[model samples]
Target: MILERQNFMNINQISAELEKEFTNKSIEQEDIEKLQALARLYQLYQAGANEIGTKLENLDAEFQVNYDHNPIHHMEERMKSVQSLLNKLVKKGYALSVENVRAHIFDIAGIRVVTNYIDDVYLIEKMLLNQSDVTLMQRKDYIAQPKTSGYRSLHIVVSVPVFQSTGSKPVNVEIQIRTVGMDMWASLEHKLRYKTDIEAELVDHYGADLHDYATELSGIEIKMQALYQKLNQYKN
Candidate 1:
C-alpha cells in the first residue's frame, strides 16, 4: 500500500479554530506558537511512520519471492487531530507545550501491522528492528501477557530520524503488530467502548463479554499456529 502524508492546518487556521471552540478560555499567542510547533512535530512523526510502513512492505515483498509467503498482510497509519491531541493533554493534566507532548504522548503517530499468523507478527517485528535506521526505544509483548481486557498485540516504540531543512531530529513512532483475529476483536471492542448514549451497566457487560471472546480468539490462534507448523513439517 502507498503511504501518503496528510495535510495539516496552518497556525492561523488552528488558532482560529481553537478560539472558536474555547470561547471563554483565553488562548495566548505563546500557546498558539506551541500548538503550531506541535503540529509540525506531528508531521515529522507522520514521515517516520510512512518510512517504517514502506520498509515493512519491502520486507514482505522480498519474503514472498524467497519464502513463498508474505508475513505482513496490511498496514494502517494515522495521526491525531489537533483538537483530539489537546483534549488528551488536558485530560492527562499536561501543559500545552512541545516538550510536554513529546514527553507524554508516544502514540500521536501510530501504525498497525496485521499479519496472517502469530509467527508472522514476530517475524516482521524482528526484521524491522534489525534495520540500522530504526532505533528501538521500547517494546511490549501483549500477546504473551495480555491486558485485563485481553488486548493482544506487540507494541513497539521506535525513533526514526527525520531530515529537516534546519537539521535532523529523531521522532518517535508506535508500531502495533497483531494477527487477523486479534485485529478483528480490537476493532469491535474499540467501537463498543466509544459508543455514546449507552447505559453504564450495558457497557460493563459488553466489556466482560469482549474479554471472554478475546481469550477464546487467542486460544484459536494458538491451535492454528500449531496446525500450520505440523503441515510445514509434513511438506518438508
Candidate 2:
C-alpha cells in the first residue's frame, strides 16, 4: 500500500534522478527530456491524489465525530511508476509522451478506499462526488455487474483541481471503493492468478471456485451489514 510522497521536485534535477531510477533500462539521451516532462506531469497527479486523499480523510473524521461511525476502513494511494506508465502506454499503442499519458491514462494516480460495509462503499462515493470542485469523469459500477474474472468494485474516475502558483489544474484520479469482503476476495484472486506461475488449466478451474467464494463473501457482507444496522439501532 503506497502513500502520498512529497512531490516537489526541482525540474533541473528530475533528469538526473530519472536517469538514475531508470538506469540501464534502454533509455536514450533524447528520451531524458521527455522523461523529465513526465516527472513534472506526475507531480500534478500526486498532488491530485493527495487532495482527494485529504478530502476522504476529513470526511471519515467528520463521520466519526458527528455520526459516531466511520464509513472508510482505510485508503491506499499510489502514483504509477515510470516503467509502468511507459509499459501501459506502449501496450495500449499510445505514444510515450506526457501529452499522450495525460490524455489516455486515467489511473496514473489511484486511490483504493476500503470500507467496513457494502453500504459504506456507495456512501463514501456519494459524499466524495457531492463536492462542488470534484468533477466525475467516468464511473464503472462493477459491483452491480461483476467482471468476467469475478472482480467487483465501484471504479470512479474524477478530476480534482490541483492548485499551483500559476493556476488550478484539473488532474484526474481513479478511485476504487469496495467493502472488506470484496477486497479480501479480490486480493486473494489477484495473488493466485497474477502473483504466481499457476497453469492456465488450474487457473480456469479455480476461477469458478473464486467466483463461488466471492458470492459467499457477498452474502456474508450483507448479513454483516444487517447485523451492524441492528446493533446501531439498538444502541440508539
TM-score of model number 1: 0.87
How do the residues 131-219 of candidate 2 rate in per-residue lDDT, one tens digit apiece?
A: 99999999999999999878889999999999998899999999999987889889989988889898999988998899888878888
lDDT of 2: 0.86
What Cα-based lDDT does every candidate model obtain? Answer: 0.83, 0.86
Supply candidate 2's per-residue lDDT for 40: 82
With candidate 1 superimposed using the best TM-score fit, by how many Å does residue 90's alpha carbon deviate from the native?
A: 2.0
Clash count, candidate 2: 0
Q: Please write out the lDDT profile of model 1 over residues 1-236, one tens digit for every residue.
A: 33334565565665566556557778777766765686577667777777787788899999989877878877888777678888889999998788898888888888888998999999998899899989998899999999998899999999888788889888889999999999999998888888566888988899899999999998898999899888877664
Worst 10 residues of 1 by lDDT: 1-10
Winner by lDDT: 2
